[model samples]
Target: GTLVEEVKGRRFAVSGSGFWQVHPASATTLVDAVLAGADVRPGDRVLDLYAGAGLFSAFLAEACAPGELVSVEGNRRASADAGENLADRPNAAVVHAPVERALRRGALGARADVVVLDPPRTGAKEAVAAIAALEPRRIVYVACDPAALARDLATFGRLGYGLESLRGFALFPMTHHVECVAVLARA
Candidate 1:
C-alpha cells in the first residue's frame, strides 16, 4: 500500500511497512465519530495519545486546525513513523514516549481543548487520569476491545468525565473484533 492518500480533499501520510495491517477507521467511521462527539474547532489544542503513524493526528489537524496537535507513542518504530507522517504539518508535534509518561510530564497542559486516546487492547488508565486532570472540552476514545473500553469508561466516570456518545465500527468484516469510538465530556 502507498504511504500517502488523498481522502476527501485531505492528504494523509501513513508509515510502517506501508502495509494495510492497521486499517484506520474508514472515512465514514471517522466522520461519524467526529460528528457524534468531537467538540473540536479551529484553533483548539489537541492531543493524540497512543498515536501510531499519526492517522488520527492528521485527521484532527485537518478538521480542528488546532493550535497544536501532539502525537505520543512509545514504540520506537511507530514513533519514528508518526514523526515522518506528521512532519509536514507545522501544528503537529510528535513525542516519542509512553502515553503515561508523556501525559505526566505536562505535555498536555490545562488549556488543551481536545484529547484523543486510541490505545491498544489494554487501555490506558494512568493516561486517562492525566487527561481528566487537563479537563479538555472533549475526549475521544478508540478501542479494539469491548472489555477494555468498558473498563476505561468506568474509570472516566470516576474521574468526572461523562460518556457523551459511542459508535462502533466493524472494521473486520466477519470476525468477533469490533472497534469503538467514545466521546467524553467533563461532568
Candidate 2:
C-alpha cells in the first residue's frame, strides 16, 4: 500500500507503515519550515539525510537544479520509494545507505551548500561530525526529540556549526511530542 501526500503543490509517495508526519498538517508545516530555514539558492548543492520517501529531496532537488542533491536513507523500502518519488528529477540521487556511512565515506560528495538533516528520535549523534566534515554552509535539522536535539546541537556547536534559528511546531496536540526545526550556519 502507498499513501500520497501533497505538500505545497508537490506530491510525495510514501510507503504504508513508513515514516510520514502523523499530524494531518505536519507535512505542509514541516516542508514550509525547512524551505524557509534552508534558504537554498539556485544551483546550491544540497544533501538530504534520512530522506524518507524523498519528501524534502523533491523540493531540494528543484531548488538546487543543475547543482546536485543526494538523498540518503537506510530503510530499504523507504529508499525504494524515494527512488521512485524522485524519478522525475534528474538532479537528485537517492542512495540506499545509512546516513552516517554515506557521510563517512564521502560517497555523497565532498561538500554541500545546504544540508537537511531529519534523523529519527535518537537524533543524528553518529552522523553529526561526519556531516560537519562536509563543511556545508548551512544545515536545517528537523528533530522530534528535544533531549536528542540538544545533545546533537552541542556536538554541532563543537564542530563549528552554530544554531542560527529554531522553530517549534506542536503537531501532536495533546501529547508532549513536538517537532523542532533548527537552522545552523558554519561559524
TM-score of each: 0.86, 0.97
lDDT by residue (1-187, candidate 1, tens digit) is 4376545565655553532334554754664575457667889888888877777777777666747888888887777877877777888888888989877888656667888888888898677778888888999998889998998899989999999888888888878998888999989
Residue pairs clashing, model 1: none
Scored by CA lDDT, what does every candidate get? 0.78, 0.92
Q: What is the lDDT of candidate 2?
A: 0.92
Clashes per candidate, residues 3 or more apart or on different chains: 0, 0
Worst 10 residues of 2 by lDDT: 5-14
List of clashing residue pairs for candidate 2: none
**Per-residue alpha-carbon lDDT of candidate 2 for residues 1-187, written as tens digits (9 for 90 to 100):** 9988888887888889798888777988898899999999989999999999988999889988888999999999999999999999999999999998888888988888999999999999989998898899999999999899999999999999999998999999999998999999999
